[model samples]
Target: MTVIAVTGHLHLTDPTVHLVRAALGRLLAGHPAAALTGVSCLAPGADALFADAVLAAGGALVAVIPSPAYRDTLDAGYTAEFDRLRHAAAEVLVLPFDTPDADAYEAANTELLRRADLLVAVWDGLPGNGRGGTAHMVAAARRAGIPVEVVWPEGAGRRPAPPA
Candidate 1:
């Protein structure tokens, strides 16, 4: 089976969300449903979109939560979707961290990379602003010899301000 992991920005515009979903769906369509396993953190933006596409394509999902309190850090609006995705995951891995912090996020990213055979990034080809960002993960994946596929569809763009 081929394992695909995702990393991307969480602040996407509405139009960009549709574009990302379509792009991810098209990519997932290239593989046999039963042979594809998607790994993600199930975060609000790209991660959630990837998980949805994986489930729609009949692929298994593996969710890697950054910390035990990761759910608490999510916006209230995303809780239901996050819970649904978590419930749908074939395997749920909660890291040893107690809280959601930068270090915890970085560790989670490392674990995702370690488990992924291929990394499907929904990045906009920009440099990451800080640690554990999509750009950082992509670079790490390349260094580890994991194949990386960037999925930034035409006209897709990030929101001007990040989600609060």
Candidate 2:
């Protein structure tokens, strides 16, 4: 079985969301569903997209929750979707963290690497705003010699940050 893990931005632009969904679906179609397992942190954007694609493709979903307070940290608008994905997960691995901080996120990413045979990065090849983001996971995958499939579709763009 091939175990694939996902790491990417959580704040993708609306257009980029569709772009990524199609790209991820195509990539996932390349594998036989019976022999595939997808791991995801199930964050708002790319991660949720990947998990949905994985399920649609008839593959197993393993959710790696960063912390106990993870759901509380997300916006209320996203909680329903998060709960749906978490419920659909074949296995849910919660990291040892009290809060959903960068440290917990990084730890979850590390757990993802330890369990995955391939790392799918929905990245734009840019530096992450902070630690425990797509770039960090990609770097870690590279260092661990795991194969990485980058899924940045043409015209994909991130959402602009709101005024401070």
Candidate 3:
């Protein structure tokens, strides 16, 4: 079987990235793909880490940009890495049909999940405050029958976010 897609949250630091990189390496080992082909939104946290890991492992990267001109309006600090991944992506699937409002983010995330066969979530597991919504999306993916592999810091699972 061809390797399925991998999706996850994007909110990791350097050390977290190191751990996550290793986790992904272990998880992706022996997958039958000339390279990994998956969708990443290029967000700073877990998204960038996932994308970077894919490229580092000699896998192809597919960027599912949230909107047409998102790079123009993304956070200042995130621009460079966004640019790097965007340029490095083997192909880009721009969802320019909608701008990135709350509804749009949800829509984009749903689309990301729709294209995936598996999801790898790396969330802090703090309570959701309507801000970072990857946790919710992860739940949604699980409901949709996509296999989910969760990666978090040592204490994360012990403190999962409260239910909606």
Candidate 4:
């Protein structure tokens, strides 16, 4: 059984989100619900979308919140999203402590990857040489010998296409 963990940027909407959802749906189409377990960080955008798809496919949704008192720390938008996930997820696990910043998000990502057999990432290019987000998480997963599935829409980061 594959325990899949999904990590992605929370800033997307509409076509990008739609494209990612469709891509993930297609990628998961052949797997049985019984053979899959899902984990998400419960953020907006891709995280929520992945959880929804997992549920729709009759797979369990395990939400790993960054903090137990997340409502106290998150902005109104994120708080609302967390509440929605509380109701939607079959299981929810709050991290033992709060993260202070980007480092914490990375730590949380590592934890999720540690428990996952597969890591699915949805990333939008953030310019420059920093890799503290989903990109870092994918690299870590690869280093740990877990398979990674990256789903970014066409032109997401401007990777050049092969010549016709």
**Candidate scoring better on TM-score of 2 and 3:** 2
Instruction: Compose the digit string of candidate 3's lDDT tens values, residues 1-164.
Output: 32334445544545766777777777666565584565778776667877887787677787877778777767688898899999999888887654666665666777778778777777655544352276777777878988877767563332232353
- Sort all candidates by TM-score, best to worst: 1, 2, 4, 3
lDDT tens digits, residue span 40-104, model 4: 88777678878877877778888877766555755576677678777878787777765535655
Count of backbone collisions within predicted model 1: 0
In model 2, where do residues sit more than 4 Å from their true spots? 162-164
> Residue 81 of candidate 3: its Cα lDDT?
87
RMSD of 4: 6.3
**How far off is residue 67 in model 1, in Å?**
0.3
- Worst 10-residue lDDT window for candidate 2 reads 155-164
Clashing pairs in 2: none
With candidate 1 superimposed using the best TM-score fit, by how many Å does residue 163's alpha carbon deviate from the native?
6.9
Candidate 4: misplaced stretches above 4 Å?
A: 73-75, 125-132, 155-164
| lDDT of candidates 1 onward, in order | 0.94, 0.94, 0.69, 0.74
Return the candidate ranking by lDDT, descending.
2, 1, 4, 3
Off by over 4 Å in 3: 1-11, 155-164
Q: Which scores better on lDDT, 1 or 4?
A: 1
Flag the better candidate by lDDT, 2 or 3.
2
lDDT (tens digit, per residue) of candidate 2 on 20-78: 99999999999999999999998999999999999999999999999988998887899
